[model samples]
Target: MDKRRIGEFEVSAIGLGCMSLSHAYGAPPPRDQAERVLKGALDEGYTFLDTAAVYGLGHNETLVGEVLGDRRGDYVLASKCGLSRGTERELNGHPDILKATCEESLRRLNTEVIDLYYLHRWDRRVPIEDSVGALAELVAQGKIKAIGLSEVSAPTLRRAHATHPIAALQTEYSPWTRNPEIAVLDACRELGVAFVAFSPVGRGFLAGGVRDPAKLEPGDFRSGMPRFQGEAFEANLKLLEALEALATEAACTPAQLCLAWLLQKDPIIVPIPGTARPKHMRENAGAAAVRLTDDIIRRIDEQVNETTVTGSRYAPAMQASVDTERTPAEAAA
Candidate 1:
């Protein structure tokens, strides 16, 4: 994998998201399997790992900590705070919560400092500056090496950046999820902030690996996602056919083709594709080596433009939380 600069730190261009090692995607992988996958990722040249305090309620971070153990310094550790889960999901950007969360993340991650710490979501109840100010304090104290924000609008990012330098901004950006191009991508480029793309494979949908949603286990996160449900699932599969055809022409897996498309779109963008299986991990990492030509990138963009995709990225309720600033009413109908 190639190395990319996230602020002052150099990390793998194709990072690994450890969320599936704990929860969301499906059943958690066995401890031995998860550990092996983590170790294998580092062995294969992946130097960036992403997790969060809320992912499996911190189980994911603890797993990474236990697996990586004394080798923490070998990779750039990135995690998120702000989004909290109690009776329901809550976005808490209060300074006190930020401080408390960082302390807990440090303990669970078994790291003295995090390379990059992100606010998982924008807390509507608090100003973004307040949250970012608290994160800046952590940087001053050397608890966090850099600051980042997730799922935030361009304006919100600018406000937060004014409080402190945001090293990166993470958002769902793939052929199926192109909303970031509206403003987020341009803002990141304008501000010289790196853009980390999570779900760059559309949560594995664009890979042609997911043929039937019914095969997904109960409680799988995809069960709740709009694009993976009923008619929407069938509609979206048609779009994947075009992507798969292109992948064949590129002599790469559908997943790799999706990632290659993103790489060609922006030099500052890095896609973190997660996997609990070692083979899948290696396959995803190989995408960085797949050189996409200008013609290929343009064909991809022309085929995957808004008219081709069939469903919204998130469910109606979850969509409201995205920092797009549009009212739910406007987004729904």
Candidate 2:
């Protein structure tokens, strides 16, 4: 596996987005199986593992702590704050709340210091400096090694970076969803901050596994997402046909094709595509070896550009948490 720098740490190019095994995709995987997959990822040379306190109300972090706590030195660990778990979940980026959340995350993660700590969302009520300042205090106190911002716009990123150097800006970026290109990507490049691509598989749609959105269980997180509902899903499924052919030509699975495409886009971009099965872990990790030629990439992107993906990446309520990003047409305007 190849390594890239995210702040002070150099981790594997392909990382593990550990949210699915416990939180977002559907029902949580059996504890034993989930543990095996988490451990298997580290053994497979995936040195970057990402989790957040908001995921499963901290269940994901606890699981990772139990499974990988003993092997903490083996990988780079990143977690998030700014999302509260009180009577109702809310974005709270106040300095005091951030401090309390960091302590809680440390206990749940069973770690002395987190390698990368992020403000999961910019709390509208608090200034970016206050949130980032709190993170800087953590860095000074030996609580976290680096700072990251998720779903933030370029101007918000600048404000936070000015408070303290941000290590990375994480958000959704994939072949089907290319919103980061409008401004976020360029902002990170200019500021020398790494861009972490979460949900690089389009929330598992690009992997060809989501054949029917209607089949998703009641509590499934994806069920609430705009893209996974009604006609939008059916339309998105048709778009996959183009990618399927390209993946076939590349001798890779659609999931790996998606990872490889993101990998080839920029050296600073690190994708954390996760799964419940260890076998799938091997396949996702193998994307590092699957090569895509310039022409193949051009053809694949052309197909993506021609196909219009319907539905917002998140529901309207969730979309409010993101700081700054624009549609391609909006950016042009």
Candidate 3:
């Protein structure tokens, strides 16, 4: 896989997102299976790994630490703070809390200094400048090499970057989720910050993994997502047919086609698609090699997008937490 720069560090174009190992999707894989995926990612040539403190309330970071801590030198490690620990979701970007979160993350990650530390979500109650300033202190103390922000708008990104050079900005970006295109993408390029894309396969929808949401495991979080629900899913599933056909023509899996499209979209974009199965990890890594033509890219843009897709990315309460720019329709809604 070709390498991309996350600030000064060069990492693989396709990174491994470690969330599914301990949280989010469903019942996590058995320890052996999870270990296989973590070890296999490095063997598959993935040079970037992303995790967060809120995932499984620190379980995810610990899992990454236990499994891959010995080989920490092999890849650039990224983790997030600001999202508070609990059974329910919450955001706490207070400087003291952020600093405290970093201390725990470092201990859990089994690292001396995290490569890229991001403020997972901006707590609206706390100014972004102050939150970023806390991160800047970590950089100064050699606790983190660089700072990042996730699920923030272009304007918020500009403000955070002004306070401190944001190494990267991450969000749920895919063919189906086009929020970043609203302005964040342009902002990253202007500021020379890497744009890290999470859920690059439409949260497994485009991967041909979940044909029927009714059959998803009982605890799988996608079962609760708007795009996976009844009417919206039915409408969205039709869009997948066109995507699957394009994948067939492109000679790649739908998941790979999605990642390849993002890779070809811009030089600074890095897609971190997560998986619990090592086979899927290898398959996602293969996407870095899948080349897409302009025609295929154009068709993908035309077929699956904010306008064509049904349902918003998040429900009202969850949506209120993020600072990302909403689509015109979403804004009006």
Candidate 4:
């Protein structure tokens, strides 16, 4: 696999997002299967692994620790703080909370130091400076090697960088989710921070695996997503048809097409697509080798975009949690 820079670490161009193995889309995968996916990613040359404390309320980190802890030196380890589960999901970016969270993550991850630590969600109640200051302290103490921010706006990124250099900025970015284009991408380019694109395959929709939202597992989060419901989902599927044709022409799967598109977007962009199945994990890793032509990329731009996509990426309540920049139409809504 090709390599990219996330701060001082040079990792695979396509990293593995270890979320779905333990949390999110639905019920957690069986322990043996999840472990195979984790170990398979390393064997597949995915040198960067991303997980967060909040995922499955610490289950994800613990799984990663158990499966990959023994092979820690083989890859770059990244985890998030600030947002976690107590009695319920919570966001706390206070210095003390961050420090304590790091301690907990360290124990759960079974690692001495995390390679990249992120403030999962900017706690609106706390200033970005304070949150980043706490991360800076972690850096100083060698608890984490680099600091990262997720789902943040450009201005927020600048403020945090003013506090301390941000190694990376992660958010949901795919053909259908164009929020990052508003400013965060340019901000990261300007500040020399890497941009990590999560859900690069449109949250499994682009992979052609989720044809019916109703059939989704009982607790599957995508079932509640706007684009996966009723008329919105039907419209989005139409967009997917054209993308699938393009993928065929490229001799790749729809998921690889989505990932390759992001890889070709910019050198600073690294997509950490997640999956529960080892087969899909290998397919995602293969995207780094799938090249897209200029005309194909142009057609993809014409076919899928903010204006063409149906429904909001998140519900109103979920939307309010992120600090990502919004388009005028979305902001007005």
Model 1 residue 40 distance off true place after TM-score fit, in angstroms: 0.4
Query: Compared with the true structure, what per-residue lDDT tens digits does model 1 show for residues 30-56?
Result: 998998899999999999999998888
The segments of candidate 1 whose C-alpha lies over 4 angstroms from its true place after superposition are: 85-89, 325-332
lDDT of 1 at 229: 88
For residue 56, give model 4's deviation from the true position in Å.
Answer: 0.6
Clashing pairs in 2: 153-324
Q: Looking at model 3, which ten-residue stretch has the lowest summed lDDT?
A: 82-91
Q: What TM-score does candidate 3 get on C-alpha atoms?
A: 0.98
Misplaced by over 4 Å in model 3 are 86-89
Query: Which candidate leads the pack in lDDT?
Result: 3
Pairs clashing in candidate 4? none
Taking the tens digit of each residue's C-alpha lDDT, what string does model 2 give over 138-233?
999999999999999999999999999999999989987888888889999999999999988887889998898888876777888877889988
Q: Return model 2's CA RMSD, one decimal.
A: 1.9
Weakest 10 consecutive residues of candidate 1 by summed lDDT: 324-333
Q: Rate residue 200 of model 3 by lDDT.
A: 97
lDDT per residue, candidate 3, 1-333, as tens digits? 899999999999999999999888889899999999999999989999999999989899999999998999999999999996533355899999899889988999999999999999999999999999999999999999999999999999999999999999999999999999999999999999999999999888989888999999878888877889999999999999999999999999999999999999999999999999999999999999999989999999999998999988787778989899999768876
lDDT of 4 by residue, 1-333 (tens): 999999999999999999998787878889999988999999999999999999888888888888888899999999999998432478888888889888988989999999999999999999999989988988999999999999999999999999999999999999989999989999999999999999999999988988989889988998878889899999999999999999999999999999999999999999999999999999999999999999999999999999998888888889999899986657766
TM-score of every model versus the real structure: 0.96, 0.96, 0.98, 0.98
Supply every candidate's count of residue pairs whose N, Cα or C atoms clash at under 3 angstroms.
Answer: 0, 1, 0, 0
